[model samples]
Target: MARLREEAERVQAALGAAEVQLERLGQARETVTEVLAEPDAATTGQARPR
Candidate 1:
């Protein structure tokens, strides 16, 4: 039982880490999309200053 509990805890920790990473990736994608949506960003390769 204790061993199972430990494994569960480890898996939970890893899941939490993955969730955080996913969130970060999502935010990055949003930023990139927004940048690309800007006028002539693709041609000039410049993003507007935040």
Candidate 2:
């Protein structure tokens, strides 16, 4: 019973983290859309640590 409870808590925590990440991704999409609306600096990629 105790183990089951612990597992449930862990699952709940992971789910919460996933939700937060999803929200951040949504916000990032909105930001990109706004940035791209200018048609000047419309681009995206990646950069490694300096």
Candidate 3:
């Protein structure tokens, strides 16, 4: 019973970490989507200086 409890705790900790990673990935996807939705600099005739 103690071993089972320890396994459960480990699984819970891993799940928490996974959730945080997922949230960060979701935010990154949102940022990329927003950037892609914007007009392209080339098309707008406003080239970005490198």
Candidate 4:
């Protein structure tokens, strides 16, 4: 019974980590989307000497 409980805990931990990773990826996608939607003049590279 103890071993089963330990396994269940490990599975739960794995699932939690996966969910966090998914959330981070989602946020990254939204950030990229926002950047892509903006004008070139509004971007970080707008002031480059080139």
Candidate 5:
């Protein structure tokens, strides 16, 4: 019974870590989507040199 409980605890910890990783990946996807949706100045031929 103790071994079973330990296994469950380990699985729970792994799940928690996976959830955090998933959230970060979701946020990164959103940022990339937003950037892709925007028009690029260079592509529009309106780019100015710094």
Candidate 6:
């Protein structure tokens, strides 16, 4: 019984860590998507040619 409880606790801790990592990855993906969706100065014809 004690061993089972310890195993469950360990598994829960690992799951929590994995969830945090997944959330960070999701946020990073959203930031990248937003950046890519925005037009740069060149694409918007706002850049001066050298």
lDDT (0 to 1) per candidate: 0.91, 0.82, 0.94, 0.88, 0.92, 0.91
lDDT of 1: 0.91
Model 3 Cα lDDT, one tens digit per residue, 1-50? 99999999999999999999999999999989988997899899987565
Model 3 per-residue lDDT at 34? 84
| Candidate 3 segments exceeding 4 Å error | 47-50
Which ten contiguous residues of candidate 3 have the minimum total lDDT? Answer: 41-50
What is the alpha-carbon lDDT for the whole of candidate 4?
0.88
Error of 3 at 16 (Å): 0.4
Q: Candidate 5 on 1-50: residue-level lDDT in tens?
A: 99999999999999999999999999999989987897898889876454
Residue pairs whose backbone atoms clash in candidate 4: none
What is the lDDT, from 0 to 100, of the residue 46 in candidate 3? 88
- Which 10-residue window of candidate 2 scores lowest in summed lDDT? 41-50
Candidate 5 lDDT score relative to the true structure: 0.92
Off by over 4 Å in 1: 41-47
The 10 consecutive residues of candidate 1 with the worst lDDT sum are: 41-50
Question: lDDT tens digits, residues 1-50, model 6?
Answer: 99999999999999999999999999999989987887787778886444
The per-residue C-alpha lDDT of model 5 at residue 10 equals 100
Residue 44's C-alpha lDDT in candidate 5? 91
Task: Return the TM-score for candidate 2, rounded to 2 decimals.
Answer: 0.75
For residues 1-50, write the lDDT of model 1, one tens digit per residue.
Answer: 99999999999999999999999999999999986777885577886575
User: How well is each residue in 1-50 modelled by candidate 4, as lDDT tens digits?
Assistant: 99999999999999999999999999999989986787776455575244
Q: Is candidate 2 or candidate 5 better by TM-score?
A: 5
Residue-pair clashes per prediction, in order, are: 0, 0, 0, 0, 0, 0
